[model samples]
Target: MRGWWQDLTDLVLPAECAGCGTPRTVLCPRCRAALAGGVPRRVRPVPEPPGLPAVYAAAAYADEVRAAVLAHKERGLISLAAPLGAALAGAVRAGLRGTAAGPPGTAGAPGGHGGGPAGGGRAPVLLVPVPSARQAVRARGHDPTRRIALAAAAGLRRGGVAARVLAVLRQRRGVSDQSGLGSRQRRENLTGALTTAPHGAALLRAGPVVLVDDLMTTGTSLAEAARAVTSAVYAARVREEMEAYRTGRSRKEGNPVYRASEMRRAYGAGHVICAAVVAASPDSVVENQELTKNVHRCR
Candidate 1:
């Protein structure tokens, strides 16, 4: 009901820009440019979390960007998802340019999943949103990250990328509000707080997975989300191996032990996981300037 009302109002009512409150526009041209005009680049927190995947961000979380994110996430300006998602799509593309080919036999492999001639030379990229706390979602009446992820997937598709949103991650436990929390505190609060859904592993095999978020601050949430996803995928592989062994199909198919070893090696090499967000802290932008020296700017 609330969503419907908001949508109706957005269509009928005059509005101010979510980013800068310019009169009579959802997002004025200048604000839209500020949101997504610059090249997306790799960003890393100062004391980067141990398990955080390589993350790319479209813009720094400051000034207009900050205001827009807050308005969309906290104040329920749901119409803002389109622009935010477009920025996130650019970030995903940037991350993909830097990602190495997947290990052979995995979905990310050249001929596997959505890749190669069978897939029309386009590899599908899965956008797995970092889950929000249930209480927060309930209070806000919507899940901001997931909403943006859906929009991002649409934008990616329109841009000729085979992309789709996968809401596979879920909160397994409650967490304290992260407001005013230090980086260390944020990490501690989110550790072991997330898990993949029961069927998430199978769906994740669709293609290369990129965790998506609206914003990244301390990087704790993304790191934890990565840990949970990796754990689930590993567990699923083990289960498959065990089932194959029990059915005596291991020898007919391939050596289960060798296959498991190869999968473990791929996991250790870290080519399978990466992340992207609409924005990151200004400090990350400063740090990423040097990293972007050789990276081709996304047109």
Candidate 2:
């Protein structure tokens, strides 16, 4: 029934592959394989931005993968979201597996905040999509990253890993276009531009977050997004500590929690298990370390 419907739909619509223009298919198998030919691996931008979470990418942004991304993002080929999302799901799984050896507070580790014991008490992985500018979304007529994140989350759930998309990040202000900006200029443009949505703190504390984006160039956006999330978590922890102190319910043994810096240090800002993007530039992968080692060491 499903195949017949697809055949009928293709016949009427005259569909073609988004990547290679193959007849009668939304995406051909060859292009789909190109999107994730190798296992996802850690990728880092040169002159890595401070506070940037470790990122995993399924494929380098080149050839067919690059064509597919551009088609979906710029050409309004919305049907490409599914295949792109499946590629993202592969990257997400790679991020999860990479963190399996991470300490507590990280996702996918035994007894970790996101991956708890085997008895169904695990915290669901939260997929936090980086926000695009309001103007950009309006111009494109869709939120591409958020849509892909949602599809990736659905794929993760189907694969037996609890996951959900959390659209909590928002732009606090506008900035100029990033098309012509260099790395440092891009960082300057995005600094302090993002913030969490109202009630984001409570939601953040419920599980470990993995930043999601469709692409990564200079890594400026991801770094800024991480800073915003960390700032929110820091503020929330401070508020909780202050309330506990005032109510005589403080958990400290002797020294009172008076110093803001101390509290910040104790809670350690925010924790992003890692990041995942559908594709990234080949030059962005760090050159100084082995591939597997880099994947494990980035926390």
Candidate 3:
């Protein structure tokens, strides 16, 4: 297979830094620092898309970080997934920490910044990829976002977060290349383009969901993916509530009443807990005096 050949080629070829072409290393120490040295922070795209999840990035997409991502994704430097995954894991942690910064009323939304039950028994966080189009994957010979997401999940589990990659979102239709599109145009192009897979609803309910991506520009893709996920969550909740109503009547003729917060807690508001990315655009860096200022802003 192509992947096997690529792996073999990496073993046989002379090593060089993917970002700067430095000899004798896949990524030089300087480049590694450029890629992940910065703290993860919340980022918002200009003209943010509807349903866009709160997102965090390990580094800004510039200089060596941008080059490294392009090398791994476009130039087939597959070995870089490890470091990129580590970067993404940092972003995931920032977003998970953001849960603790939830505004005043969202206390029971699950996975708070605490270490115990307020965090939903420390349930495993589901990292869902914003899928690449099938055509794009065929042209590129691999799914870049999903590859990095797998690595991120591994890194997260190692760090004791109980994480797993969930490739549940799928493109439901064709889309034009995003290269020439502006933010609003990108949003229009991606509207209703992604949907959850069969039985994905049940899987999504397993734990807190975190949208994962290699890079974010206008955030259209993450927004669409979030819409699809939350829609499924809403439908699943309705079904559960209906079933509960029927069962409650049969058992005690109205012995139990479910609070709205109970429902919101069940699905985390169908809003993704947040999104994690390897890198973000520089303009999105919210420079605040208080480090936690941007943390609760996403809600």
The best candidate by lDDT is 1
Winner on TM-score (2 vs 3): 2
Report the C-alpha lDDT of model 2 over 69-173, residue by residue, as the tens digit: 987777666677888898898888888777654334434665554333223555677889999898878877678899899989888877776778889999999
Q: Give all TM-scores, in the order shown.
A: 0.86, 0.84, 0.83
**Which pairs clash inside model 2?**
none
Which regions in candidate 2 have their CA more than 4 angstroms from the true location?
A: 1-14, 100-107, 111-119, 254-270, 286-299
lDDT of each model, Cα atoms only?
Answer: 0.77, 0.76, 0.75
Question: For each candidate, C-alpha RMSD in Å?
Answer: 4.5, 5.7, 5.5
What does candidate 3 score on TM? Answer: 0.83
Per-residue lDDT of model 1, residues 84-187, tens digit only: 99999888877766665553333344444422222454446788999998888888888999999999888877766677888989988889999899999999
**Best of the candidates, TM-score:** 1
Q: Candidate 3, which segments miss by more than 4 Å at Cα?
A: 1-3, 11-14, 101-121, 246-271, 287-299
